[model samples]
Target: MPRFDITIVGELNLDLILYGLPESLPPERELLASRLTLTLGSSSAILAHNLAVLGSGVGFLSRIGDDALGEISLAKLAESGADVSKVRRARGSTTGLTVILARPESRHILTYPGAMFEMGFEDLDLRYLADARHFHVSSFYLHRALRHRLPEVFARMKAAGLTTSLDTNDDPDDRWDGELDQTLPSVDVLLLNAHEATRTARAANLEEALEKLSKRTPVLVVKTGAEGAIARRGREEYRTRPRAVETVDAVGAGDSFDAGFLHQFLRGADLERCIAFGSLAGAFSTTRPGGTEAFRDRAHFEEFFSHHSTAEADALPSPKPAPLQAKP
Candidate 1:
């Protein structure tokens, strides 16, 4: 049996969010606002942390800098009950940080790539990562040094008989084509937002993007905030609307949705159940200040999940017949 239900390989960092900031930032002027929070950030870390909190056996692998920021980020992830034994520390460079100036209806995010961009393929423990039932990666564009070899990583995982997923959060460059075409073929599930889907597929619109991407992976999940999420599996399609909640911040809502969706998926739930749960998780994330702050509260998450999650059997899906392997 695999040692973990899911193993994640990606970036780890902290998000510094400040609320009550003016919408416009005039250069050369010192602007002060109210409210601040520093919490676990980065799509990979956020998803891993929330997934662990949702009772999955999660193993995380990443490289951080040898610094206090790395320590804090690592500790935060660990607090969520994930196994971070494979995380490494690069020398010299500082760990990455994101500064978010959040307003009532808008936000400006500034990021420093830091040590995250320096992590190379050599930092990975292939055996450790393969000792899992599933493998996942996030923030494709942010993985500068490792992007070129991600396809190889996914191929190896697939070869080892593990399912895989990728959530290419966003392309800062907006090019949306960095080994992505190579990586898609190995992906069992592709999770992204509506905007990301359109941008990635380069389709004229959402409907066209879904049609294009669905052919690339066995499952394609597109998260639409407020309206909920949609999923596609071959000819079948499923959609779910989010439950109403008093929102605090939406920093990690999408990642939370991934955690929820994948959690149900690993349980072998149907796509409808997965989408419903995913929407619940996304809504729950907004009740707290940062992406992970709400999840850090065990009581809060347990209660929220109990109320939203449907009562269902927890059975592993029957295994599919193995694909024919090429002669070695």
Candidate 2:
């Protein structure tokens, strides 16, 4: 077996979220949605778990704080069966965290990169990467130093014949200006949302955006919420709509979708099948309050999927009266 079906190196973080409220607003009183929940989050964690659920051996490289949150993060990853031998831990830093300002079916978040910033490229030991078959990177901004070193690192992975996948969590820090402009082309599979795809491709329309993205990386998948998602690999292009169901929460929807799609894609499934799988996972996530919590491995996904017919039977309704992306 390959050292790992997929190896993910990234900036890891804990999410502190408060979401869901009930009753109509009274202006001054400020109506709050009821039913709040907290769960493990962070793009890399979501990707790793989904990969494992998809039945691939996963290895994650990251840094976490020594506090309770850090402990929880590690415990959760271990529980998910991810090999954490390469995860680095910091003694005094607080685990990187983000607070989700959420409405029942929608979400808004205030993210803080706390200790994830500690996961600089200098900490990456290539020996671990050498054994991996695929490398997925989720955080490009948490570490300033890593931004410059990305090309060299990925080049090494490429040399080892690993397929590269990247999810961009653009840093609001100084590096955002054009750092990604230089970094995106080196990847083999580029995963992103519609907005991110447009940003990277410098295009306004979806098709044009996909064309631009594919020029750099052979496969590009863009998640378009509600409208579903689109993917292009060489001459292949496919899209899928969200599963229609009443949602309970919308927190980790997108990341979960990535998990589902990557699981199928890596297995050599076709474009349409991959989009269906990923979108199904995204829709499944809406039923839960957090991203990782909603993520179930292959058995769970399979069991749930087997119950439905035509795949599209999974679209979920907005659990909250309002949508998450609309605000802020």
Candidate 3:
């Protein structure tokens, strides 16, 4: 019924990913030896890029500083085929940034909220909501300024007849309070990591946390890093093992998973398949560098997915970690 399959309205960030080894967390001085990677990393931004790679007509609305960082961000989005006109260029804020200190395939972030904190319901394109099948908002915790818009956007999305979803970044102060109950009733899904699930709703365990969230939202996806992830749709539950790959940088891994899940889901794929698809995206991203940089086109994703993920509804590969997945 809608012209665009899905629309993601949120932050887009530029990541300066610093590389190192697993022995010990590298100091800033040691970064010179490890190599710093400048790449695309954003939640709604990367997911929208992955969705565009899947050939979906997507619209994204966000604000960026009118600087090289913003230009690079726009260039990355345009190359991915996501609609770019909705991205607003601002005067002072210089786009969002995450400084990632990395190991062999994993990373630790020191993020600077920058311009991402500048977004609010004031930046939205109201008509865009009416034209999309789904509307998802994510990554507000990078800054405190945007939190006020969640209720407004959720309220508007429901009134516009758009299927809504919310994904959040990890922050104790930023975790959804009772706002989720007000927000979740309109949200069709909530994409949260194990930490967020365990922390936000204050449940004793992961399953209980999901149970509590699902009572309000229609579906819940809880991702538990290396242990894998789970998805619940009403009475049905589907689980999948993460694709075993060399970890490049865990930065944006969750966003990659979200992109993978939403891409197939927009095509109306089944729950298990969607979970599998998301796992592949999540896994493949870890095998490379940067946030969005980890993702390849659909063809590359499908190939790696087929090779790593189980073919039938069998057990997941008993992963034996050895070498990293970097194509060195």
Candidate 4:
């Protein structure tokens, strides 16, 4: 058997979320928030952590700074039962950190790339990454050093006989043109939010974006927040409504959605079931302060899924046969 069900290559960092912050910040004034929660941040780490918690064997590889933040982030991910044995720590750089000023209905996210921008293609181990049933990449735009080589990474993963997925989180530069065109052809699944879909496709509307993006990958998933999520597999399309819950903050909801959808996906569930479970998982994330807090509570995690998942929806065939030995 392969060592992991899914392997991820991306960033690992910490999120410092401050609640009750003013909508607009004035330059000279001292602003204070009511509450604070420091937790694991970064889309890749969130998905890997939650997927492992959901019972999928996960392997994660990332480059981090040799700092306290990096250690804390690595430890947090390891606590999820993921293998972080290959995580690299660079001596001079500091780990990335995101400071979220969360207001009532909106949030301002400020990030210092730090070591996140330092990871290069040289840091990746193809054989290690390919020793899995699936491969996923997130925050495509953030991998400055490794950006150009991502297409090769995806291609090699596909050539190694492993399915692959990509979540091009957000483009801080707003230039949607990276190696995305080259990478899309090898991706079996493509995940995006409505805004990201529109932006990436350069479409005038969501409908156009969906139509255009669906053709690029075998499966296209667009996260719609409160409206739930939608998936397209060729001519067939599936959607699921959002679960009603008292939301604390939406910190890691989308990543949790990816985790849920992928967990079901690796189990050979249909798209409809994957979408529903994804929506359910997303709603559960909002009950806590950060993206991963709700998941950290074993009782809350199991209770939420047990109450939300249907027997029929939960029944999925076992994963497909593991991929062949990865080529060097």
TM-score of 3: 0.86
Against the unseen true structure, what C-alpha lDDT does each candidate score? 0.87, 0.70, 0.73, 0.88
Return the lDDT, model 3, position 94. 81
Tens digits of per-residue lDDT, candidate 2, 16-93, equal 666554423355776664555556788888778756654667788888887888887777777777888887788877
Least well predicted 10-residue stretch by lDDT in candidate 1: 319-328
Q: Write the per-residue lDDT of candidate 3 for residues 135-214, one digit (tens) a residue.
A: 88887465356676677777787787777778876774654574555566667778999989877788899878878776
lDDT of 1 by residue, 9-95 (tens): 999999999998888889999899899999999999999998888778789999999999999999999998899999998889789
* TM-score for each of the candidates: 0.94, 0.85, 0.86, 0.95
Best by lDDT: 4
Which has the greatest TM-score?
4
Rank order (by TM-score, best first): 4, 1, 3, 2
Q: In order, what is each prediction's RMSD in angstroms?
A: 4.3, 7.7, 7.4, 3.0
* Deviation from native of the Cα of residue 113 in model 1, angstroms: 0.9
Candidate 2 wrong stretches, greater than 4 Å: 21-33, 104-106, 170-177, 296-302, 309-328
How many angstroms is residue 138 displaced in model 1 relative to the true structure, after the best TM-score fit?
0.5
Supply candidate 2's per-residue lDDT for 243: 78
TM-score of predicted model 1? 0.94
> Which portions of model 4 show Cα errors greater than 4 Å?
311-328
Candidate 2 global TM-score: 0.85
* Count of steric clashes across candidates, in order: 0, 19, 3, 0
Evaluate model 2: give its lDDT. 0.70
